[model samples]
Target: MFSQSVRSFTKQALQWSRIKLVHQRITLTKFTTLFFYLALFNCIILIALQTVAFVDNEDATEIITGFLNQANVTQDHIIYISNNELLKCKDLPSLSDANCETWLQEDDGDDDNDSNDSKSRRSLGGFFSARSVSVPRHHSENAKTEKYSNGTISGLELDNGKVLDTSCIQSLIWLNDVIHDSMAEDVVTLVFQIWLFFLSLATILNESLPHLGAAIAGHVLVTAWAGYRIRNTHKLREHYQELIVHQVCEGVDFLGAWWDVRTDHTIPILVFNVIAFVLATYLATRLYRVYARETFNRVRASPRLHKIYKLVLVLSVCVQLSGFFTVAATAMWLDKASTGSINRVAKHLVLYRAVFSTMAVLEIPWAILGWICIRSENRRQFWIFAGISVLLLASSSAIFASPLYQFIFQTWPFFASMTIVSYLLILVITVLGVWSRTQFGKGLPEFLKEEEKLEGADFAPVYIPDLKDRKSFDSEKGHGSDIDTEPIASLPPLLASQPLHKPPPAEKRYRTSSVYSDINRDTVKLSSTPPLAQAILSEQSPVSDCPPTPNRSNFETASRSPLSRTPGDRSERSRNSLPGNPRPINIQESSSGRPGRTGLIRI
Candidate 1:
């Protein structure tokens, strides 16, 4: 009864073990499907939000252009003011004479007429028609001469004896440029998001750890970019508000109204950014979990080089991520410094942009090559990767020593810090990559391939014949014993019940070349022998039925018993007993009517 219960328990355990593997496979499939759908939804929503942002940017540009036109502000006027340092009425020498009051009165009348005309035109024109107004050309050369001499200057004196400051005009121009840049950034981001969406789909289809890692890197980049844009927008708004509070201008009310409209449009984008960031973070975490689990499995398969391989992968990801952020920050810094008061040569800026952009763009391909090299243990690819790393390191170092280094530190300290961090990370990756190159081709790739095959086999479907069909088939094959009729799940327990004193039939024995072949063959042999052999061998020997298991043993036994002789030995003995030159023996028919040969087979 106890043995029967053990058999039942073992059968149930085998069934449950198979069920567990199926359940895990099903769960993973469901998870990947859900992730793919969620990512698609995210991509759709981002597209809508970016579309709205693009429209808002267009509207803001039109509004700014309309306001500039109504104020009669031309690019030439702005350039003239900037070049002459004409900031206020006190800075204008033409506004300090007794005729200034008369000029102010005339200017006020002319401004009233211009305002009336602008209002009529605006009323007649459509929404974007504000930009359609042809700006009157300004005589910057004449203005320059009038500023130094005593020539009368037009539009210098305003109502209340105040002159328009360049600060307000500069702020408006800056804001317009910011909006345009935001629009461009939106387009770029939209493209990147689309690329990421497809990458995610590929990741789901292939379930590749490296692909998942790349997706996570993309998510991090998008999230950081969104945050940076948000911060920059907030700074722009604050600067505009500060200008309105400190300076008195005729367009202040218009600016406030336009700003309110712009803010309303911006709020939706902010909400979208928040949602995108949340989704990105969630997806990144999920992908990271998957990546880490797969990486763990691969590492476990090849533990000899696991430490170095894992470190290389980790450093490669870090390098890619840092490289992306560094490029972004450097671009932002370039934009800010190029528009700032600092005097930088154009050639230097172009060089800086080119170098950083190239490095950033190469990061992805470099990481891919590194992964391939590591997996395939390709020495040539590793050398190429190492050489590129050295070049990038040297180039980065050269950039640090360039003239713009101080400019970056002073103008954009964040960029400077990111550069430093990225440089250090690159250095580490280079060193670790070279070290890992030496440890390649040591059976790690083969181990990983074996692991993949095992996983695939676990998920593969198995067909089990019905019990009645199996029994019929066994009977037809002349193997219809009770052992052959048992279900597969119960066969292991029944085989385990065989007595240990009996050895397996020599015809069924075979050798294996695997490292663990001895253990595996011994286990299979012990479980496959007939139970009756135990009783017969024990009764003849007068020893216990079960013997202690040995660590290692050969299947071939030389006990001189008929059952113990191998097939080859038996055949050779028959040939020798056939009335030959060296040896001969007699064969006779037994009572069972079967010809029997009696002889000892010697090895």
Candidate 2:
């Protein structure tokens, strides 16, 4: 009786342990579900935009002074320029009389040379000076002037103009001497404070209209023919839309001097994030297949590719830093026609921004890679970090910063554009993730070995279906948050269902993976597929070769009801798997916690 009681107690403990483990797992999953994507949804709109109406005429006056200085410096200097022109008056030859600078002809004799010298001396009466050149100005506001680089004003006029700081881009162009006429200046001439009043009215009206119409429409659509399904799908669509709106509408939606910080220092820091985003999304994405997927497996075992990956990592960091420089450029150049003192200050803003945020955006990929390396048990921790990293990047880029916000706040124009770029950034991140996953899935014998070991196990009971030919895994049914088709559907009673021996407890938790080892280091031979052909990616892998998963009894069962596939766990395994021409996987999963992983793998 004692022995029997001990056995019963042991059985109950084991069962209780499993239940507790499951409960803990469920709680962790729910926590991750609540936090990870919630943060992602919140981050879509944290852009700062506030309009500062420039009341000072000093900045405008300074711009005019610089132009006048430039005109004065170049006016008297005779220019024989087409492709290039002398930047400083001193660089030009001193004019002599009616005939300016002329190349000396040695054979023309000393008399002609002397005559030429005299002509040159005559023209050099007013040796290049700041007072030489002038800018042409009309008598009044309506004066029409054409062909302005050579035009100059004899007298100085300091006109004070007011503009929204958001109008900085147009202002920059005007200052750069890009716009040659007063007509271009007229755009900023109108009083815009009245528009603010109208804007307030519109905001009120927009608020007054209770979105009940939209809400009712959503309910009616959900209730019509397919209530459960329509409601779910409709809700999903609405949620996605709300997510976007939330991103776009984050923070104090006021654009009045909110960007004064850009005018001060944080400009280049912002620019760095922009650059990282652009290169990671635009440049890195282009070669991601070659670097991450194509060459990754080949270099998995080679120290050379590791160095290359490190190089890529370094380059990515550099590009992020480069983004800071781009912002620095913005800071310096985002001003109106200003003098060297102002431009110099702008450049300092760039450098300052760089030093500040170098680590923030630079660590984005490292955070992503960390999540990639996490074991499933600890996945939630890593994913939280991943979400944080992505959010940091989004905030850094100002993806939610809109031009309208800038219009109100009078700041850098690109800040608003930067908000929109978050979409591209997310897409790029998705691409990088897919490429990484795909590379991981395809290459390294170790990865294959893990899949094989899992396949051989009776406890987990995973089926290795032929996935190389399909677009993606078709079975999204699973016990996890990943949104993949045919993902793991939890453990089945495989040992009881069939007369198969379960592996010893010691062997169950782990297996040796040689994915990174024992590859032919000779010239690689690529797998043959048409230039454009579809292929499936599987997280399900095998050891060197997984022993056939099919039960021997499957063939001999007497009453085989046509071997119909089960509704759940009824999919066909690969009938005849092909030899792998292994490459690295490149896939990016989402934090959305949908039915499956986003599986952002590419061809």
Candidate 3:
């Protein structure tokens, strides 16, 4: 709710700001797509980390359950723990088999000893083990004493009074005291720590490092492509003609343009789904970039920090992965030694849940970075996105840290369900790059944006080639005469009246408006009309001047009369009325039309 409220307030502020926004480049290459892929990949990683976390929680749960059932802690004393009920006999009220030694054998070596101990069987639960018991002395060299119990001949006990006729203990315990310490999670933690250290290095080498290289190369490649695309973007959309303007008393609330991804009725759902999902995801992240930039700038991070950050990030991942694998190894070890009968159902739940819950804890940091990276365009969108991010992270955390998550897998006899979620999450996240590619660490646009935004206030241009009278430069030159007419095409052609060779250097220099304004004025808005049009508008009254291209002079002569028209492009204005190509403008009407200007201008 707090997040949502933030979103609402932020949205209002952003919406207002957007209205005031003058212009922004609408090109795609300025964006680093690696960040988008990273966002996707980060989610995938979270899913994976969540799985490992679940497994770890299982380990914790098993250990906790074991402790609950344990009779002792130190190796000095034996603690017999089981997953299920290990001993049961309803017939004998005072009898119990908590201890495991000295059960009666079928044939007693000494008949006299059997006679003395015969009453003991009736009092005890049939063939019972006395943990602190005396075994009948046997002459046979073959028989061995049971280690867990006292001097007893181990034998199965059958409860005769019950209809089931069952031997009570029904659980499995594989490793005894001899190997429990060796196979425990703490030991596994160390081993997996080693395993994960290497595994993460491998991940870094194969997945991260390669991807980073690909992205670096991709940056150069994409930038080149964008430059190429812009050089020849003459093909305007065909639908631009359909831009029927509507007059609104209050102006428009929203401007939306829709494109049909699938115009045909028979597009395959699989292909459509793929395309739509990708496009939507891209648009969302692109919109997100604006917001993400603000945060990256706030953090004051940079790609230059990648080397150290990568080392640290990899190390953190190594620690986390080690913790994860340790949980898995411990669970597998416990499952083998589990005794279902001795331990209650509640105990199994506890044992498995605790171990796996720990796995979720380690993924929290990655999730945070992801949230920080999945930006929205403005405060409003950012707030909303933040809320969603929080929800995704919290859900994963719940699955990782909560008991409900353990129950999800514990109910299954095998870990098939849990494993699926685990595998999918890992695969998707690694590929997706943690909800945002840039969020993972470095070499990304998120880093780039920060680099751009956080430059020192004491910035100095490389060189200040002092110029003269920019406002005068602006006033004197018409469209053909202005040096900045084709800014992207480089400096405008040499002035017509200026000498072809160097005539002489000027003595004085002056700054136009301010040094900064003149130097960095790419984003400033000029008048909507072209300089040539401005010349026509001021030089000639609204009564004259249409263009004359090729043989369309007669048709345009009538069109230029401004009989009932407004000041719009002649070509655009002629669009709706004419049958053939719209008549070209007739340039013969004005006082200093092309004849007079071209006559005077010569470099």
Candidate number achieving the greatest lDDT relative to the actual structure: 1
Question: Over the stretch 279-347, how does candidate 2's per-residue lDDT look in tens digits?
Answer: 323322222322233233422245643543443343233233223223332233233213322232132
Residue pair clashes in candidate 1: none
TM values, all candidates:
0.52, 0.21, 0.22
TM-score of 3: 0.22
Q: Give me the runs in candidate 2 sitting further than 4 Å from their true place.
A: 1-173, 176-385, 393-405, 408-423, 430-603
State the C-alpha lDDT per candidate. 0.51, 0.30, 0.31
Error of 2 at 123 (Å): 35
Sliding window of 10 residues with minimal summed lDDT for model 3: 240-249
Residues 429-523 of candidate 1 have per-residue lDDT tens digits of 78878777777767767766765675576363222334655554333323444554434546578776774455456554432232233345443
Native-referenced Cα lDDT, model 3: 0.31
The candidate maximizing TM-score is 1
Error in Å for residue 397 of model 1: 4.1
Candidate 3 residue spans exceeding 4 A from truth: 1-178, 184-194, 206-326, 329-333, 336-602
